[model samples]
Each structure stands twice: as C-alpha cells, then as structure tokens.
Target: MGSAGVRLGRLKANTSALFVCDIQEKFRGLIHGMPAVVDTASRLVRSAEVLEIPVFVTEQYPKALGNTVAELALPPKALVFEKTKFSMCTSDVDKAFRKMNLDGIGQVLLCGIETHVCVLQTVLDLVEKHNVEVHVCVDGVSSQRETDRSVALRRLQGLPNVFLCTSEMAMFQLAGDSKHPKFKQISALAKEKRPDQLSAL
Candidate 1:
C-alpha cells in the first residue's frame, strides 16, 4: 500500500495510459517467458483500445533489437518511439506525450521486457521525474533470468509511486465493474492463461 496521504487510487481509463517497452524480436529467445509477456501485453493493448485509453510504445534501438514482436497486436493509433536510452523518459518520448496531449494523464500502465534493466529504469524515471503513478504488469514483464525479474520487482515494490500488479488485475480495475461496457471482453481476455513462469508471481 502507498502512504495514507498519497491517494494512490485505482486506475481510471480516462486518466491512465499504457506504455509498452522494448518487447522486441531480439529478446524473444533471450528473455524468459517471452510468449507470456507478448500475450499479456497484447491483451493490455487490446483492452486499452476497447476502453479508449491512450497507448504508447518504445523500441530500444530498433536497428539492433528489431521492432516490437509481431504477435502483439499494437493498436493502429498507438504512438511508437525508437530510442537508444535504457530509460524511456527521453526527450523524444516526452515530445510524443506532449503531441498526444497527455498532460492530464495521472497513471501509466507499463508492460514489456528485460524487467531488471530498461523496465526498471523507466519505472523509476516515470515516478521520480514525471511525478506520475506507475503500475507494472508483473506477468507482462521479464528478463533473461528469473532471478533478475524477481529482484527488480522486489526493488520496485519499495517505491511509493510504483504499484505492482498483474495484467488481469489492471484490466478489471480499469473496467471498474461488471457493468462496464468493456467488461465482457476484458473478462474473456483475463481467462487466457499466461506462461507457467508467471504462475508464482
């Protein structure tokens, strides 16, 4: 839980956005549970579209790492940025946020690869520099080693502005209730199984 005065509340579709980071073709073989990460990230992207939430994606050095995985169904209007920076909070990313008119966004939902490196750095930067609440999809993030992912998650959990969650939890929270228009679609998406590697998380 966050500090009592912090007011870290549930995600509101209108005030939240999704950021997919560095889940590229190059790491498909290197990262553990790549399939699960792609699947969960895809589900989140689709759910975001259904809920009319904005989505942004970052590819770390696309020339070397390749583009985002084809399995993931990125929304047509999603903003895509290619960057060399490990932390995605670069000027280019900032420009994209500005272009998208994201000044009102309060929370960012994050999903993607190498949890210990790029993902961790981006989460810290978003919370400290941007002053926005960050929620990580545990099942949608990973590293080459399980230990790296576990350690990174443990470290991130200690941050007051960083909220750790699963893809299903985020989807439901964003939907708010069973009566939400997208509830049935989100519910179906949640029923899909993630890799066994994410089972313990």
Candidate 2:
C-alpha cells in the first residue's frame, strides 16, 4: 500500500527496465499462482515492446532449471542475462547492468517469480547500491507460501526507494494513455484469463 512516488524524470523509456527473475521451468510449479505470473509477465513484455523500453531477464542456471516458461513468449529484443549469483549486484552482474546503460536508469520496475528470495534480494541491491527506485508488482511475483511472500513485501515497503504495486497499476503507468494504438492489445494481454471477459478480448 505504500509507495515511493515514481521518479518521472528517470522513469522515461531509457531510464527504466523490467527485470524478470527466474520464471523458468524448475521454479514455475513451485510458486503460488504460476499461470497468473506468466500472464502478468507476458503483459509486461508486451507493454515494454510497444513503448520501446528495454526489458531484461535472468535465468538462474538454466542447464539445471530450464528456460523461461513457454507462456511468457519473451520478446526477441529483450536482454537475457545469465547468472549464478543470487544478487545481481555482484561485480560481474553490475558490469552487465552498466553495459546496458542502466547506470542512468533511476527506476527499475521489477516483476518475476519467487518473491521471497531472488526478487527481494535484487530489489534491495538495486535500492542500496545502484540507488535506483524499485517498484515490484505484487500480483506479478509470488512465493509458494503466502506468509513468506507477505513478509518480504512488508520489508520491501519499508525500504527507502521501493514501491509495492499490483499488476494493473504497473501496466497502466507504463501505458500512459488509453488512446495509444497498442492499448487494446496490451489490455487484452492483461485480461487474458478473466473467465467472464476472456472471450471478449
């Protein structure tokens, strides 16, 4: 419910990126709502593509865990960064981040699987070291246990530069306009699974 106001100056196309942490095979079945996570991430990727914003993804040891889930259908333009480290702020990872021109990125809108560990660690690192604003969409990330997910969200909300939001809020912010041509397409992606409305889209 708490929010660190969006940094409009740095939230522009070039100053923000979406980091999708291990929403891969080995971890998919273990999360609270796998399908919803896939849908939300898919919608995010679609929005990012329409807006021409950079999207970054991480695969945690894909050889053992497997690739990102099939439902996501990540954009080919997206940057897929491989890493073994839990925290992406480590020397090598940070270098990759810098190479992406993320040093100027003031806000990082994050969404992915496994909210309690990898997502939490990455958010803290981005806030503490990179001094980047962190906004995590609650509905887009989850843990196998609700209690752990709740605890992690509470801790993230207390941080200096972090915001916890629902998937709708994040998507609308990125959309910036209902008149945008891709609005219906992006909206369709967001509403893909609502039983009553799915057919309409």
Candidate 3:
C-alpha cells in the first residue's frame, strides 16, 4: 500500500532505500555492459546520498570475488556487507531492513551485477519474505550474457511487488515533481548522461 494504502505506484523519499549488489572487481571485465552498469549504479548512489536515503550494499564472497569496484564511490555512511550467499538477504541486511521498516521504509531501489544470480535471488527474498515494494533498475543490473540478464529481468517483471525501472525513473519518482526540495539536484543528475546514452544532437 502507498499514500492511500491502496496501490504502491509511487516512491516516497522517506520510504526508500538503495541496494547495490555484487558490483565487484573480479567480475569487472566479465560482465556484459559493465561500464554502463557501473555508470548507472554510481548515479544511483549519488542520488541516494543526495536524497538522504540509506544505502545497503552487499559483496558476494568478497574474499574471492574481490571488493566492490572503486568507481562506485560508496559513501562512508552506506552499509557495506560481505556475504557468501548469492542473495544479499543476509541476517545483517534483514536486521537493517527491519530497523528501517520501523522508521517507515518499505520501498527498495535495487541496482547491481549478475542480474540472473544475486540480483534475482535478492529480489525474490525481498518481495516474498520481506513483503516490501521492490524497484529493480534495468540499466543498473546485468549479467555476463545478455540472454541471462534479459531472462532474469523478464521473470522479475512478472513477480508481484517488483517494479522495473531505469535509474532516472526511480529518482524522479522519489522527488515526485519540480517542487520537491531536491528537484534541482535531481535534474542536474538527469542531465549528466554517459556518452553511450547520449544521442547525436
């Protein structure tokens, strides 16, 4: 339920958190569209910081997969956790979510690597178990193979409480409109498009 406790068709700043999963060094050159994925993830992180939304990040088996890529520039306040499981739904994460839920956070904005694996599993746990509204950023998550990534996204689309969107779409949904206090900052973010995303003008 959202504003009127009927449909969750919007995202409120007070009810949102950002989740970045397994965008690590080991998979750098292995994942398809890695550059774009990192770009969108970075943008989302910056937006989350500006919007004062708590950030949750998980590194899958970091000892072997290595750490989150340096380019992501996670802030000092963002919760970064290490996990051996493919899903980011660890005890620690659940604890944090529980705390946030108490404070009215029921929406999750997710972006990260290996869409078919960690991202998919985490989405399942979030919707099925946590019972929170999940927004998966399409441009922000991917796998080594386009087919895997596409299939995972398609499956995720069908799941209840799971919303698929681009990074910018989530940002605007949070801000709501031009009158939002942080609208200017979000507009600036929307303008700074990556080269690949920019078209000839």
Candidate 4:
C-alpha cells in the first residue's frame, strides 16, 4: 500500500477480465437489492463476451448453494468453477488467473453478493497477493444488510490498486473510444436503466 501499490492504469480491453463471484440461486431472495445486482452483473458479462475479455465465474459450494442464477446465461468461453472457499482465489481460480496474467491480464472486474465477505476477501488477495489492479462493480454487489454492503464498499475504496465503480462505467472504460470495433455493442449496454439509476424506495 506504499508507492508500489498505486495502479491507476486504464482498463485496457486485452489486459482485463471480469470475475463474477457467487451470484448463485440460493441468494435470490435473501440478498439485498438482488435484482439490481444481477442486472449489473449481466450487463458486464454481455459486454465482456462481445469484447472478448476473459470471464471467470465462481459458485460457492454449489452442491448446497445451487448454481449461478438462471438469468446469467454465460458465454460458451466463460470459465465456471465450484468453490467451497469464500475467496474465489482458490487454487484452481488463482492458477488460471495467474496464467491469464502471463498473457497480459492486469486488471480484474469483480461483481457478486456478500460484499463484505467473499467480495472483500477476493479484493484483498488480488491486490496484496496477486498484485492485480481490481475494480469492484458497486451496483453489482450486495449483502443481506445495507450497512454491511456500504461499509465494505467504503473500505474497498480506501485500498490501493482497488477501486469501486458501476458496471456501465466499466464497460465504457474497457471500450475506451467510440471508434472501437465493439463500440456499438458496448453503447447498447449503456442505454438500459442501470441499477445505479434505481430510485429511492
């Protein structure tokens, strides 16, 4: 978290990946703002597919927790894994992630439930252990309680090499310019009413 920690690099398409953590079926009715969170994650997944960025999905103890929700129709190229640990940095995931690193992956986007738990732990490991710059989808992660989610987000914002951002914002950043070949698809993603736009209840 010293001079070595500042990773303010732009999210280059070729060097970026999206990590969708445990948005499983079991969390459907229990997590706060579940619908909006799913909506955000879906947008990123769709965008990543069009951009050809790698996508990694983790299902927390799927045997008991169930698989990723049906709404998220993953791309054929996505890497999906079952995990019993809170942090998706399990041996398999970490190995694959590191392999991607050797191929130019430098930044990772994180989106899923239990912001303070799995999401938080994953962020710490990515930055501290793997030295990867990470961006968390603020509107794509939730917890059973608002306080927990809010506090976790604030804590994440304070870390070096870790940033909090909305899914739409991230899509555009990865695309970089309107002249990008995938601009049309990325632009379409922005037209929808994103979770961040939801009104006060």
Candidate 5:
C-alpha cells in the first residue's frame, strides 16, 4: 500500500461504505467456496449496519445471472444496482453514489464473487478512477478456481490504493476501540471460524 493509502487507513464508520459485488444466485453452484463467501459477506453486511456504514450491492446482468443470493440479508436501505460491466463503478453505480451523497466518503470496503473478474475490476476502477482507498475482504471473495482467486489477490496487493484484508480485520478496524458501542456485537460476528477452503488460500 502507498503512503497516502496508509495515511487514510483508519476506517471511520462515517466515511466508509461497504460495496458487495456480484454475489448472485447463478454463481452459487459454480464459485469455489460459495457458502463461505456468503457467510463472510453477510457478516460484514450486518457489522456495517451496526456501525451505521452505508452498504452498496451490485448484480451483473441480474436478469441472466439471477439476483443476489438469498442468504445475504441486505438491509432495506442498501443501494442495489444492475450492471453489464465487470466493474461496479459503472454509470448506474456512480449515479447511486452521487444519490447517496458520498462525495466525502474516502474508504470502500469491498467483497463478493469472482475475485478475478468482477471483484478485481471493481477494485481497480475504484482506485484508478474514483481515487478511493479500498479494502478487500479476502474471505468474502472467491473465484471458480483457487488459482484464479490467488492470482487476483496477488495483483490486488500490487495496487497502492488497495488493501487486502479479512472480514474480521476490517470490522475490527472499523470498530477501532473495544469500548465502541457496537464493538461487542461486531466482535461476536468474528467468532465463527473461516471456511477451511479460504483458510488454505
């Protein structure tokens, strides 16, 4: 990570948002460790709610790929968008960001499916295009194959503006202090063991 990225590293609830990309129903059977991805992603979503961090979700060609998995208990206020692009930073997504008045938001917590594709592209765009600091939850993202996921993570690490992290790590950082009002609730979410498949990765 670059110095600038580290300088803005603290994940304040007010300036951070969660972006869940393309964790759709059609990918459930095909993606590696689908169950684990959903579990971690859901935990992050719930934690974000506790922190009062806004959540954004995207569906890549929802009509063809189906909607986001039923397992993710998306909040009623979450912004859900449909897109044909691999990157979540599409026109629709941009409009949603503007609509949400995210001009001052500086950090993006990213998760979801096909790490080598949609997730990878989205992270790159968020950094290169929007100039936002991005934290990627490794346990909450996957590909159809382990090698692909590994490669994508490696590439992401090379980006100065992108920080590779686990869901638990990000949540704790967001919480910042043990005395934080939501710390207990958020800490409980991390008690669950990460999936063996993701652990091996």
Candidate 6:
C-alpha cells in the first residue's frame, strides 16, 4: 500500500475550483457574526480569484434572500447557481461543476454563511455524492447561534477528506509559491480594510 510516489492530495494547486455557498444578502445578516464572516469570506474569494481558480457560487433562493452579499466581489461571469435545497448537488450547481471540469480538480475549497445548514449540507453532498475533496475556511462560515456553529464544524471535522482551514490557510494553499506572480497583491489584499481594496485584488 505504501508505494513510493507523490501523493496527489498533498500537491498544491491540484485543483482550481472554489464553491462559495449561501452567503446571501438576507441570510448572512441573520448569522451570528456577520461582519467577521463577510470579511473572511471576501478574503477567501479574492485569494481564489487571484490564483485563477474557477469560482462557483450559490444563493439559496436568491429571489427570497435577494442576492449574495456585495463584499464577495464576484467576477463578471462567475458561475452562480441558485437553489432551493441546501445541498448544492441538487440544483444547477452540479451542472456548473461539470462545466468547470471537476475530474482534475482534486480539491474544492468552500466558504459561506450559516455553517450549520447550507454550508454543512453542501460540503457533505460534495464529498459523499461527488467525491470532491473539501477544504472549509472556518472563519468564513457562521451560524445563527454559536452552539450550532460549533456543532456544524464538529460534524464536518469527522469527514476523512475535509480540512477545516482558516482564511490564511486557504490563501497560502492557493498561493502555491512565494514566487507566484500575484503574491504581493494577494498579501496586500490580506491586509485590506477599505471597500476599494476589493477591486484591486
């Protein structure tokens, strides 16, 4: 079983896909810690985009929740799929994933609001149903209650392929190397506090 070969799972930039789940306008404001979630999620999106990762976004019934929060800085043509079910698999999300060509994408990075409901369900579905390796940014997800948030993370931590990462962790993983062309801009984005910083990254 221990063949001497490079483990693909340990390779960086092996996947260029990101799934930002249910950080909708109405829903995110109701989460326990809106500001922190928004800040971290924004940063995660920026890092992913800077690394040229294909972004997949979800809005659980955007007609009802309005739309994803403005802080995300969505690309002009990001794959944004709306769904009624909490699991992104059940909706056009899967189709979007197909379009993104997931076969070579060994990892899927996840960030969003309501850690217990949409984010948790989506992560499980992506792993169990689609077999996508998952990386969750802990600071980017939240719940309406601290207890529920803690419980959700506990549940996700049990998954064999799921890594509970921080915003900084996700950023560096995508960075690949200090020599990556966007390193400086990405570093500056990490310290950005003003709204205008969104466009620069």
Q: lDDT per model, in order?
A: 0.86, 0.73, 0.88, 0.88, 0.86, 0.74
Ranking by lDDT: 4, 3, 1, 5, 6, 2
Question: Residue by residue across 1-201, what tens digits does model 1's lDDT show?
Answer: 257666565888988999999989999889898888888899999999999999989999999989999877788988899998998778988776655445688789999988999999999888877778899999899999999999999998888788898888899999998998789998988887666647434
Error of 1 at 109 (Å): 0.6
lDDT of 5: 0.86
TM-score of each: 0.92, 0.83, 0.93, 0.93, 0.92, 0.86
Q: Is candidate 5 or candidate 6 better by lDDT?
A: 5
For candidate 2, give the lDDT. Answer: 0.73
TM-score of 4: 0.93
Model 3 poorest ten-residue lDDT run = 192-201
Give RMSD (Å) of candidate 5 vs. truth: 2.2
Q: Which lDDT value does model 5 have at 184?
A: 91
- Evaluated at residue 29, the lDDT of candidate 3 is 87
Candidate 4's error at 170, in angstroms? Answer: 0.5
Model 4: per-residue Cα lDDT over 1-201, one tens digit each? 236655675687889999999999999999999999889889999999999999999999999999998878899999999998899899999999999998889899999988999999999989987888999988888899988888889899889888778787789899999999899989988888755432221
Q: What lDDT tens digits, residue by residue, belong to model 3 across residues 1-201?
A: 756666554888889999999999999889888888888899899999989999999998889999999988999999999998889999999998888888899889999988999999999999877888899998888899888888899899888888888888888998888998889998898888673531100
Clashing residue pairs found in predicted model 3? none
Give the lDDT of residue 22 in candidate 1.
91
* Candidate 5 residue lDDT tens string, 151-183: 999999888778888888899999999999888
**lDDT at position 35, candidate 6:** 76
Writing each residue's lDDT as its tens digit, candidate 6 over 135-201 gives 8878777788888888889889887678787767667767867798888977887767732211100
Model 6 worst lDDT run, 10 consecutive residues = 192-201
Q: Report residue 96 deviation for candidate 5 (angstroms).
A: 2.4
